[model samples]
Target: MSTTSTEPARRAGWRTETFARLDERLDRVLGATAKEFEKLRVRTVGDLMLHVPRRYFSGTELSDLSQLRVGEEVAVLARVLRTDVHQGHGGRSARGGMNSRLTSVISDDHGRLELTFFGKPQVMDYWRRQLTPGARGIFAGKVGEFRGTRQLTHPDFVILGDHGEIVGGAKRNAVLAEVTRQPLIGLYPATAKLRTWTIAQSVGLALDQLAGLPDPLPAAVRRQARVIGLEQAYRAVHQPQSKDEIDGGRERLRFDEAFALQLTMARRRADAKAHGAIPRVRRDGGLLAAFDARLPFTLTAGQVEVSEQLMSELARPQPMQRLLQGEVGSGKTIVALRAMLAVVDAGGQAALLAPTEVLATQHYQTVLKLLGDLAGGGLLAGAGPSTDVVLLTGSMPVAQKRAVKLKAAAGEAGIVIGTHALLGEGVQFADLGLVVVDEQHRFGVEQRAALSAKAAAQPHVLVMTATPIPRSVAMTVFGDLEVSTLKEVPAGRADVGTVVVDAKNHPGWVERAWQRVIEEVGAGRQAYVVCARISSQPKRKSTDAYAEDLDTDPGGEDIEPAAAAVDVYAELSGGPLKDLRVDLLHGQLSSEEKDAAMSRFASGETDVLVATTVVEVGVDVPNASMMVILDADRFGISQLHQLRGRIGRGGHPGVCLLLTKTAAGTTARDRLDAVASTRDGFVLADVDLEQRREGDVLGASQSGGRSSLRLLRVLDDADLIAEAREIAEACVAADPELIDPGLSDIVTHVERQAAGDWLERT
Candidate 1:
């Protein structure tokens, strides 16, 4: 094709050209100060061009001054008729005169308006010079009435003519011409000193250099995807002449982002397939069969299906990169145990990584209880091969931790469970076959890779998460990993009833909430009173002793402190619920204290556990049927869902009362209402994604500074992502290594996106 020959040259030119050549520097192009330019962070012409507008403003609808409402914002082009400086009528100051302000009168053909600015003498003089008699310019601001006259207070004005040593009048006229020619005005994200006008001017200069830029996407692929050329996209996004052009440009950019991400995922999958892993296949299901026989309940069909999928992956010589997602009480723990048993049966060690020490201990205890007979030295002692399970945490006694580590190093521990302590040095495994990461989102990609690197042979990875992810988010965020969903809860589990209690609407809601907790406790059911903060401290007096004399202190001595877990625990134990057993738990407590508190709560000795979100995961108590979350508006949607999931695990129905000070018709109220309406985590996940921006979903540790995705929205651009994924699959299938010259830029972009991630070494 004719386009092929010139494309390389264009690409080379764009890569080599500097911002200086394109006149896009703040100082040279927009007359900005050095400090202001430092805040812009635009280095090259490419960077300037990529700084797209946050929103657009229309310049075509210029309103006449006579038609402007008192509170409405309007724009007008007018000629200055007079400028005057007048002193205020207030009492004389220590400098022997009151403050002064500069006032200017400007008029259009039909009406006139006054502009006022109050400031120091030098600043007022500067404005007085700019608004000299007969000066013409554009002014935009809110219209206000000042003593029967329509006026604009400190309006944003752009002088239309050339001043002493500045640019010529012709250049000013050209800027005005460009502004009038465009259908919309671009409002860019800017710093305090670098306004939108400065950014627009710099972008205008950069657009002129688009002719020599290369399209990151190949021509055939672009045509197939129906995306605009990269050069045209840059032009239209920065300087669009029509709405259609803007839409096309935005779509192309979104596609480019999504395609790049999918390409990276595709390459990762291919590379993972190329690597060799030790097949963890076990012919004898002796230990697994025995473990399942001891279970109190039967496995759900969804769990069985997912277990089969995991077994199949474990039998392969390639590493299994799978994500197991389910709602709370979805039997994910049992499924993970089954996978671990498979590896153990194959004469290999399996490691279970938990995000917190409490969770690690919980898993260790649950596994110990489940493996009652088959756990050597038990009732079913000689029924099957004995499997040794060891627990490692940061706070374990030194001698005990050393014993656990020795067992792990010698391959004596068939299944090792621990928190981040497992990632420390000297924590080696004899032969790690499978790694199950619980609460996968709590760990970073680097930590996952570190665990994988612990073994000589590649290990099968099964990442488990209780937070439900929407289908669209999973496709984009976890695109490289195969997913298995466990939607069905085990039989006999009761659904939880959630209600939102507005403290603002009901005057006695707080007392009623406490009474409800008391009722639940009196009925022989435990309660969890969750608080946002661990402790509440009294407000200290002002630091400046002279603040009161100067009348500068904003007093808050009369305001009561917010309720904390400790405060609430003390109150319930000594005051209202004095007869009941109450305990406090938080992250600040020592490991032994935490363990004690949890043990008491689990054993039904503590009637109420006032804790923070540390109890959000893995602290299952069947007797605790009621939970009251104070300041529920402060918690995120997914977090609220997870906290509520801690209840209703037993056969009895659970109740979750969400207490909020937020009023009706607020966003916080809406979020609480959504959570109260349905127990479906998938629905709430969609709402969560909608509320927040698509962040570093892969893991925030991998992304250095910039976000993984820029223009693509996982929720809104699902269709585009799907299409790009299809094309990316084909592209990677054709060129697994991405060696084609046409994909060189794309390859580089992906590498940059990966940063120092473990995949970079691969």
Candidate 2:
């Protein structure tokens, strides 16, 4: 097979050929429906070959009947001694009802084994005809013991002619030979109607068409990476002869995926560098220095380091596409503010886009407070130029929103902060130089691109996320953007203690957890009761709500029954926490109601606040020392960590109680235990990445779209990703347009990907 795109156009190659040309209805060949084929996304011969097996099942070695143990999956070849059927004990039909056992005794040279077929009369009849007295066959199933005798239940078997002699001569011999030759059975990721056998057969047909397939990766790159050719990798992945072949093939394909992504990103970076950006570089540092001087607390070393990096990037003419990642309560906001100040100091407008209205409002308040007199609407008097901070949100009054828009368009507002409303059609900036995105993952690629497009010159973009991303994940999901991490917590920040409360193992633990919350409230510290849902109504129930707990009313008449925030808030307020001031908060609540509830909690008027995961990010409260998470297992590790961060901001020791109804040994319990064991966000991030797949980290799973990665694993292929990145950087540096003959396919693929989604195309 030719592994080169440089081949003549006249050459017949699988890489350039469409599946329709080979066979329009590949569904017929695979014995699957069109819907099933669509699910696999198989449109070409390449796609068919790319549908690798999810797992492989090894055929058990044939074992003697006497040596078989109960619960052991084994294969046995024996001759049938006798067959019999008995009626059910409860006076039911022996063949169709409760008592249905088609029993047969099969014997090898060493001992005899019993076979039982239950509720499968057709199979029983077929087996009876095939496995008559002294007839031989091969059987495979899990061993079971009934009445002290070893037996096989619902065994899969193939009869080899008769016991005395082999019949059908060469034909029968060939069938046996084929079965004996294949020891491993591949189990593919298939739809309900499409079995693994059909997929395997179809793949076999596709492999035959792999001759002269042009390889996308250059020969030199493959040699340096130690990866096999494309054709070999595909064959080994689908029809491997040994474990080593499978490993080798997977590694090669993984490298290919990583390389493709890195090449696209490298080209994008190069393209951005070629474009001119309005450098918002500042030397006097008037606004930034003034803002920093007024801060009540000192900056951590990590924050200082990251802020310097951002300043340096802003000094360059190329637009800065950077991601600032930090753990909860790590002072990322301070670093972002400094960068924004630098831009504004250079006579440019800066915009901060938030994912939620609550977060946007909180950021606006934080920036206003931090800027102090320099934020000169009323406080500064005559101190230099007046820096007006404006807020715009979907829920804001129309008149107020119009005023903010006017200020933004006229370049009068030094800083503008808002949610998706900033991406609205009418919103525009006069000299937009910097764009800061908070909780960056919550927004899609299109949203970010839309904001960037508002600037006449490509704006300096800074994306910030409190959710710590593992190194491997950062390399793949955020490969296109430069990364800066804040690993240090600010001085005097209190440590949070996390505990897992096994509600299933100990029934009374739930009550004890609530009692802890009450005790925290009594101590003059606020408490938070986080639920998975927002309301008890079926139609209004959030996707994360626990279905079983939706109708249970622990508190009397006035309160509704549900595990949602409204029901939980009512139950706690009217029940155990009756004397304490409790308030309800959730996404379903009106903007004014949400603002009021948060304000009351912040002001200490509400002793306890019951809410959903809406409080997971950007909600800061110093007095809230305790958090009780109901159905904690439903939340991801990163979310739980962010929620825990809401407390312990006031230098008081904080406690996090995770209440889970799941059993101890399940995957859910394991995840909860991981969260409770440590407070390190980086460690928890790695664990989170392992627990879920790459799709979750990239936001593809939630969007109902396929992940950009097809073969690479963020956890296992870190080294390969690094290597591919180096090669891609070099490749793009040498040929920015990728017009080289060897790289034409890559250019075409990248362009196609970019046109499909804002993420891949960029």
- TM-score top scorer: 2
lDDT of the candidates, in the order given: 0.74, 0.73
lDDT of 2 by residue, 1-762 (tens): 111111123222323332223334555554544456675667556567667876553443223567554555555657778988654432445444554467889887688899887654554465567667866666666667789998877776655542222332212344343433444445565543454445676677667766656666778888888999887888788878877888888888888778877886786677667766788886474787778777888888898888888998998888898999998899999899899888888878889999888898889888887887677752111247447889998998899999999988887787899998998899999888899999987765456767877888888889999888888777776777899988888878898999999877796988888888888888899999999778766443232222112122111112222368888888899998898999988988888888999999989999999999788888888999999999887777778888999999987999999987777766667888999998889999888778766655665332233455777888888888899899889988878767665454554454444445544422
Per-residue error for 287 in candidate 1, Å, reads 1.5
Which lDDT tens digits does candidate 1 get at residues 269-381? Answer: 77667767788885575678778777888899999999999999999999998999998889999999999988888878899999888889889888888887555531111
Whole-model lDDT, model 1: 0.74
Q: State residue 633's C-alpha deviation in candidate 1, in Å.
A: 1.0
Range of the 10 consecutive residues with the lowest summed lDDT in candidate 1: 162-171
Candidate 1's error at 307, in angstroms?
Answer: 1.1
Q: Which residue pairs collide in model 1, if any?
A: none
